[model samples]
Target: MAEHKTNAMRLLDKAGIRYRVWNYDPGDGNIHGTAVAAKIGKPPETVFKTLVAHQGASLFVYVIPVGSELDLKQAAKAAGAKKIEMLPVKDLLKHTGYIRGGCSPVGMKKLYPTYIDDSAMKLETILVSAGKIGLQVELEPASLAAQVSAKYAPLAKRGAGEAASN
Candidate 1:
């Protein structure tokens, strides 16, 4: 196994959350979906990816399943914010200490507003990045959210109902 260390791994340690690390080749330059599809052999829609967005001066983290996108307006409505926007790549990296594709909802540089898609509750467990590309962790969504003090909301920009109706 390829040994790796990342802030996400550290957070799990801090919380005493049980997790199993899965590593794969970092090549192919695939996004989170591709990695999940290849590694777990699951459809991309079943894999969730972490995202960073902003509500005024504060930055928030949103973790939603892959194949779905974060709807700024929907997220703002869910979070009781008048406005929300995708955080700048630079600012996101600085605040979370994680680069894109490697960002985890846990172990961020600073704790800001956090929201996890309610859809996650449907799954027994899900995979999230291990604070680095090519590495992922398997854990329960509810447990993961509790460890990070995250809240649940309708964070997806789309739904199976055809309308992101939230």
Candidate 2:
């Protein structure tokens, strides 16, 4: 197997964090979190998606289960902002140094405050993007949180009319 190094993977290596990388064929550009989870053979609940949000001038990062939605009201409170909205997709790469499906909470253009949904605490490990499409990194939830200085919060809820992805 060939070695592939992404910024996130390098950061983990430098920090001495233990993680396992999984790769899949992206196949025509469908990179939704749920699809990634399926391709990687992990339950969606144990696979996290990184989302960027903004309140006023500050940017925030939210990590939640692939199948769940970020509760904007709860996210706002957890972020200590009056309100929060998802950052526009057009600005994702400029702000985070990553495109939509490849954004990892670990390595970005800058270290913004990061929050992982509290439910992750119950799992032994969680999977997140490896800062590239077709790759994922799996590690202890606590380790990931520590790597990014993330706080745990109740930031996720099942989307309306959607089945839970347990």
- What is the C-alpha local distance difference test score of each model? 0.78, 0.91
lDDT of 2 by residue, 94-121 (tens): 9999998889999999999999998899
Q: Give the lowest summed-lDDT range of ten residues in model 2.
A: 157-166
Ten contiguous residues with the weakest lDDT in model 1:
157-166
lDDT at position 16, candidate 2: 97
* Candidate number of the best lDDT: 2
Clashing pairs in 2: none
**Candidate 1's residue-wise lDDT over 1-166, tens digit each?**
3365677887788888888787766676456565565776766655789988887687778888777888888788777888988898878777888888788887888887788888787778887888887888888888888887888888887746765434
